[model samples]
Target: MDNNLEFKTIIKRSFLDNSKRQLIINSDYIQFEDKDLATDYFTKFLSSEIKDYRYGVRWIRGAKFTIGRDYQIFIRNNENKIIKINFKSFYGINKSLHFKNYSGILNSLLKFYFNKIASDFIEKFQNQLEFSICNVHFSDKNIMIETNSIIKKKQNTILWKDVRTKDYRTYFAIYSQENPANINQCYNYKDDWNTAILNTVIRTILKNKE
Candidate 1:
């Protein structure tokens, strides 16, 4: 895919804030309470943004769910031509994958799903083109993708701001097919649909908590 075109597609999708769910450009994570909520979040998001696309294209991926919350993986492929894969999941209480056993369990899950997404994309694209991952994690607390590099950075740099909410607390991770570079790349556009969906989900979660 053309870098500029991919950037544009992401930017366009990111800037639409009226969307029920907010999209974090360069972020490879998402969180939701359950599959139904996750589906509703994405469906409402796409409905308000893309009129030509159908939400029913989503499928039941052959992956095991741990009984509580699982990320709903959505695949959009067209016979070795166009393939776009996305993932979304909700976070649960004490769902912290790491902080202690970061590498053994939490990181392992991250790496597994991340690689799963990449591998599936390769198969769908006939192992020809390089694809990216979009991950969303909806949690009140921040998640640390624990890494053990001594020369790593600590803080996150914000690139774009949400227009409606004007909040910049979200984090993003951008991965390439080959090299590892600056993952904190930010954008100027706001994904309205993502924000709306996220705001709705979070609000509901908080209400339930009360």
Candidate 2:
């Protein structure tokens, strides 16, 4: 990836073939004993915290709620305890896609909406348990790359090569370490968000260089 490349151009090319771009939030090891109580708790939380945030809640199954104009949240359960919360937001190509500081804009978007939601949930349950939070920007596109050719030299990203298809290749993922957080603070900040993403991209490219 070129540092000088415009972010919109990268997005445009990444989705040129109608690929999907997603913002994903994963809350790991959430510890809530009662499922009903957990659902009831979040229902009230969403109703109160997101009333003015312009999000509508659509209940899907038990403890699963889709909020916001373009996002969904669901509580993952294990042995009757709520284990994790998964949140996702999708984006399509639109007028706001073009911006000079795309990284900055994304940072603000995540902090203003996604992070805020996750932070609220963490704070609400901080006394019950401590957990790890991870945010990911996932891009799916059609490409041709050799998986065997890739040397596993990087820790931040990975590429997947499809053997069944001649053309439907994909880069499997890019991710960072889990960000530790507590009631009063989270490790992720807007100041280093862009840098973290850029470094991940650079590391991915360097690892896959021909």
Who wins the TM-score comparison? 2
Query: Compared with the true structure, what per-residue lDDT tens digits does model 2 show for residues 55-121?
Result: 1122233345532222212232222222222222223234233333243434433443445545444
Residue 155 miss distance in model 2 (angstroms): 17
lDDT of 1 at 204: 38
* Residue 142 in model 1: lDDT: 24
| TM per candidate | 0.19, 0.20
Per-residue CA lDDT of model 1 for 110-170, tens digit only, reads: 2323334333443533433332222223223321122224697343222112111122433
Collision pairs in model 2: none
lDDT of each: 0.27, 0.27
Clash number by candidate, in order = 31, 0
**Candidate 1: TM-score?**
0.19
